[model samples]
Target chain A: DAGITQSPRHKVTETGTPVTLRCHQTENHRYMYWYRQDPGHGLRLIHYSYGVKDTDKGEVSDGYSVSRSKTEDFLLTLESATSSQTSVYFCAISDSYGTRGYNEQFFGPGTRLTVL
Target chain B: SQQGEEDPQALSIQEGENATMNCSYKTSINNLQWYRQNSGRGLVHLILIRSNEREKHSGRLRVTLDTSKKSSSLLITASRAADTASYFCAQPGTGTGNQFYFGTGTSLTVIP
Candidate 1:
């Protein structure tokens, strides 16, 4: 596996509450991504970080935020949880993208979050 | 918005039969990749086919890309029960740097 681990593998939080999920990697990869998987929606990117303190929004950035203060850690926070935010969140790491060869992303186990 | 859409949302086949899934996408792409996800697990990278390449194989998995049609297909030969999972195709969005857009996915059930 890709030496990636997600904390709080399963969680249930009430609506309007704050929640944060953590992704820690040991591969020292330059790219880290957060995605949410829902039925009929596949996996939608929530946020991603290219380097320390360098982050960008993805296709489904609403109601979510991310931060990467170190190369090994990436965090996803739901400012105020909602029923629609309930889904399986996955964290991925990649060495490079759009480069000459090598664009495969290694994924972590995943985190299942439920909003009541 | 999702860039890729997979056909036959669900599939069922015998253990020894072959399994094929098709993905159609909008917009240009540099490459297309396939992934598998078991129940309650993260996605596992299966294979990738570049836009310039027509076909590529890895073990029993073969991927074909047709840029003219903007589509791709994945074939798994002699499928086994272990191959039962949801398969998805992904590609980077146009003008988006390092971001991947995934399809809704096809759920496969290989009967033993």
Candidate 2:
């Protein structure tokens, strides 16, 4: 219940078209992450932003990009949507990485995207 | 690059029974955490256990960690229909930052 919300709860786009998913949080968390979930692959990290205007690639960053212009918003974009890119995208937030010990991650409701 | 894989990818149990899920990691770590996801909703934090601890309890939840085996288990006592969801375990990744690697997850279906 970290006050996280993802836009376009459901979407369908044609292949080769551009698509973007937005994640917004009310909490001023320091870290934000984007992940995609597939049938057998589980949840794979796509991109994450530690702070405003600072982002980095994740395990499955290919064909995907992210931008964070503020503390509350994290955006994931598919330059050219592909059938393989269809999956459920989830956004997460954390106060810290449990660097010193342990921390919890809050997740958004999630967005389901489909490509044809 | 550490990763966690859960056993018995899917489980089914009757209400009031006990449900146990196991998570195995590739590399040793100091801490591990579990999360639960209800179908289409997001994931909710469940519990956490550190390396030095053998067992920890949170209400109906019990978490046990074995560093020697690099594995952890979660037990839910007196399961209920509401407990039907997917469970995942996570551990810190290779880098020093806040990256974490999560397991493939175990889907539990509590029969009413």
Top model number, lDDT: 1
Writing each residue's lDDT as its tens digit, candidate 2 over B1-112 gives: 3558898799999999999999999887778899999999888888889889999999999999999999999999999999999999998665533667889999999999
Candidate 1 residue B108 C-alpha distance from true site, Å: 0.6
Listed per candidate, the RMSD to the true structure in angstroms reads 1.5, 1.6
lDDT of 1 by residue, B1-112 (tens): 7558998899999999999999998878889999999988888899888888999999999999999999999999999999999999998765334678888899999999
DockQ of candidate 1 (2 decimals): 0.67
Per-candidate chain B TM: 0.95, 0.95
Q: Model 1 Cα displacement at A38 (Å)?
A: 0.5
lDDT of each: 0.90, 0.89
* Model 1 per-residue lDDT tens digits across residues A1-116: 58999999999999999999999999998889999988888888889888899999998999999999999999999999999999999999888654566487889999999999
* lDDT of candidate 2 over A1-116, digit per residue (tens): 57999999999999999999999999999889999998766788888888999898889999999999999999999999999999999999987745566667889999999999
| Model 2 complex DockQ against the native | 0.64
Q: What's the i-RMS for candidate 2 in angstroms?
A: 1.7
